[model samples]
Structures are given as structure tokens and as C-alpha cells.
Target: MSSPVKQTLKWAQKLLPACDGDLNHAKRQLVWLKEKIISDRPGGAIDDKLSEQEQTQLEKYINQRVFDHKPLQYILGTQPFCDLDIVTRPPILIPRWETEEWTYKVIQLMHQHLDKSRPLRILDICTGSGCIALALAKHLPKDSAQIIGLDISNKAISLANHNLNIHKLSIRNTVEFREKDVFNLDLKEPVDMIVSNPPYITHDEYNSLDPDVKEWEDPRALVADEQGTRIHKRIIQVAKHCRPYNNDLPRLIMEVGGTHQIKPLTEEMQINGLKDIEVWKDLADKDRVIVAH
Candidate 1:
């Protein structure tokens, strides 16, 4: 036990340079890697420790890839969003802290304004990892809200379903995962709300992303044409097709790029006939989510 711990500590020391000399960050990655190796074992026993050979293999694994600045969520295959442990994998955008922050705020607003007696239907477009959808399930009334998480990647849908089941969210039955291109989405009924953290990174910005993201994460899930507002425009255009429920305008909440996205996105929402448009900033006070009816 001490041998493996000592070995990983040495490995962490060697990896510290790649973590910007942050010893804590390097140690956290070591711990995460150990957890991953153990969880892959039968029954996932917590007391199970690695053998000398296994520790050597783990060291090689970290040295080869993860310490080279790969996103830690992809390395560990999970991320915490709200109170749920969401499954994370490649080709699906990992849940961002900013997205989680705004999602909780949206849920709070829904609780205050939405009719609790009636069922609430929510559509989550580009629902990578299903973090936003599952977060809503964990928070909203399990008996009332029906959430659908749509992503173009089948892998993302599968991972989202895995997250939904693993977390044991009581609302899992009502939370559905589907593979659909948001650009061509056509709903049969108008949902109470539509929320998305779609691909909003501009092409130029995508080119300049960190190698950790550029090499490991999915480009299709990140970059958009036309200054990152192309998909945002499509989302707004499709809003005209959805019918409003309960004599109230259907709610639209979407995560945007930055302050640069505010003016054009708001104008696009208004042109698409959405009303009551507003911008919500993230923790950094950067404009992040656009809320409209």
C-alpha cells in the first residue's frame, strides 16, 4: 500500500511541471487515476489497492497522456455538476462550471414562476453529458418535469444515459436521452422550456484553443461558423415552430459565448419573435446565458 502511494507521489512530482507547478493539481490527477483503475475492477471495492505492476502501469499511463495537459474530466470519465456525478467522455463537451451555475439559476426561476401543479416539459438541445438535463431532474419536482436531452453524437447520448442511471436520479424515467440534430429538430408539442449550451466557440477561437481541448475534445461540439452565433441563430429560428403552453410564452434559455455574443444573439432572438429577452452573466460577470420567452 505504501509502496504504491510512494510510487504515485514520485510520479506526481515528475508531472508537476506540466500542471504549472501546482503540486495539489498533480496529486489530484494521481488520485483520479487510481480511482479510475480501481473502479474498472469487479465490484469496484474501495479497499482494493494496486499491485506493483499495476502501479508501474498507472505511472506510464499518466506520464504518456494525462500529464500532457489533457482535460481531467476526460481522464477520469466523470465530472460533478450540481449534486450529480455525471459521466464524461470524448466527443461530448464536458460540463462547464459556468453552465452549471446558470442552470441552477434557471431552475430557481422556474420554481418561482412555473405552475407546479402541471407537468413541465423541457428540451435540452446539444445536451452533452446530459449534465444540464440531469441537473434539472435532480432539482425540479420528479413527478412533474419531463426532460429530454438531445445530442447529435450517439456516444454523448449513451454517456448521458449512463449518468442518468448511475446517479440514481428518481426522475430518470422522465429524463430521456435522444440523438437529434438541433438544426432540424421538430417537436410535435410545445414544451414549457427549452435550454441549451450549444456549440458557440467561433472558428478562429477554436483554432487557438489549448491543445488539451483541441486534441481531445470534439471540434463539432465546440466550433461554429459565423462568429459562433450560427447555431444560436438556428435555435432561435426553430423557436417560431414551437407552440406556447399555458397561455404563457415558452421559455428559452441558452448559454452564449461572451460579451461579444450579447448584442447579435439578443437581436436574433427578437427577430425570431421571442419576447422578454435578457442576458444572465456567469460567475466571472461575463454575459453567459440568454433568457427569453
Candidate 2:
């Protein structure tokens, strides 16, 4: 008889023709569902058996996946980011590996360079689920950083607060979530750093993305005008207007689209008087993040 893993994966893929239809993604979801719902162990010779009830539940989930084209993360209702179990919700962008990787890097840089003798204030704009802010609060030197997470959606704020409360016991600093529009945002106090994983996907690009993303994720959290540089410019303007923090702190650390975004964003930062622009590429060697102070 075929291994249970193989059998289930085959069944899952057959049901996904109406969905993303990517075998690899289906396999991943299959394994994750098995591990989570059935308590099956990963790796090695797979021998876990599913009970009738379990099989029924899995079928229901697979049906949802195929018929609704819903993302697995949405079905499971959580995403792991920066070692934190971030809550995922519909219409709100889920945390991606890219965001997690860069957030960890930013935390490390902040730990090494930020002047922790005094309080440090950081803003995470368009912060869906508050993953960045929560992760920073969890890993960064606690009790000294006041991280604020801002989003334009009320549901986003509610979900972000829910995620924060889930980990509030371990996080010792102040992390607040608010629903505010970035375009009309006005801040009085200067901040040490501003980090964002804004919507930079172009309309055309968004159209071509996987159904799991195009169908489920909020377009406002993924698409921007001006060829994906609209929100980036507004963020740059925010960084430009903020007075420089005292001595050796990054003013802006923002995730951007691949290589095409770097030059123009760097120029925008220069024109706005922000210096020390640095491009941080992802493991694929494509420019993924831009930093300036």
C-alpha cells in the first residue's frame, strides 16, 4: 500500500485543481494539516493513520481550500514569524518569511546600536497583525522600547491587539496598536526608527500572484500607486520630516520591492535629506530592504 503521506497528498492535490493548483504548496499544507490536526510526526517513514473523524475534518479543510481558494494560513489561523506564533486573519496580510527575516535583522541591529540608556520609540506603519512590533518587543531589550503599530483597518487593529495580548506576558515593553491612515498621519514626537513592510505590489503584479494571495489578502496591504513606490515615498517623507535622533540610530528601515525600487527610493531619501542609504538584499541577492538615517 502507498504511504499515508503520499496517499493524502495525492488526494489533496486532486481537490486543489480549482485552487492554487501548485503541488508543492498543496504538499506543504497537507503535511502541516496532518501534523497539526492529527498529531502526526514529520520526517522519516511516515506511518500515521487517520481516524474516520480526522479524515472527515481533513476533507472539509481540503474542500474549503479548493472551493474558496483560501490560504492554508487562513485555515490554520496562525503564522509563525520571528519565532512568534502570529495570528492570521482574512483580508489582512499575513506575515511572510521575508518580513520575518528582515525583522530579525532589524532587531539585531537595534540591539547592537540603539542607545538603550533612554527610551526608544519605533513606529511600524501598516502593521497588520502587529507581527513586527510584537516580535521586536519580544526580542529587543524589553522595558526600554515603546513600539507603536499603526494600520488603516479597524479589523487589523483588533487582530493586532489580539496577537499582542497573546504574548503580552512575555513582552515587557509598551506595544500599542492603532487604526490610522498613513497618508494623513501627523506625529509630534521624533522617533528613533520607522520600519514598515508596506504594500508595494503593483496592480499588474498583484493580478498575477497566486490565488491564495490575490483572492484572500487585502489589496490595500499589497498594492500601491505610482508603480509600487507611492507608499514608499510617503514613508520616506515621514522619515524626512522627523528630527534626527541623538547620535547613531537608524531613522528608517523599510522593506521594498526588488531591484527596480532601490534607485528611485534612494533618490527620494536623498532629496528629503535622509543620509546613509543602504540596500539590504534577501538571500536571493535581490534588493529587498532599504535603510537610511
Best candidate (score: TM-score): 2
- Model 1, 129-222: lDDT tens per residue? 9999988888876566888899998888899889888876455337889999987788786677788998999988987888878887889889
Model 1 poorest 10 in a row by lDDT: 241-250
lDDT of 2: 0.85
lDDT of each: 0.80, 0.85
- Candidate 1: which stretches are off by over 4 Å? 1-9, 38-50, 66-69, 243-250
Q: What does candidate 2 score on TM?
A: 0.89
Candidate 1 lDDT at 147 equals: 89
Residues 79-155 of candidate 2 have per-residue lDDT tens digits of 99988899999999989998888999988887778674677888999899999999999998867688999999999
TM-score of each: 0.88, 0.89
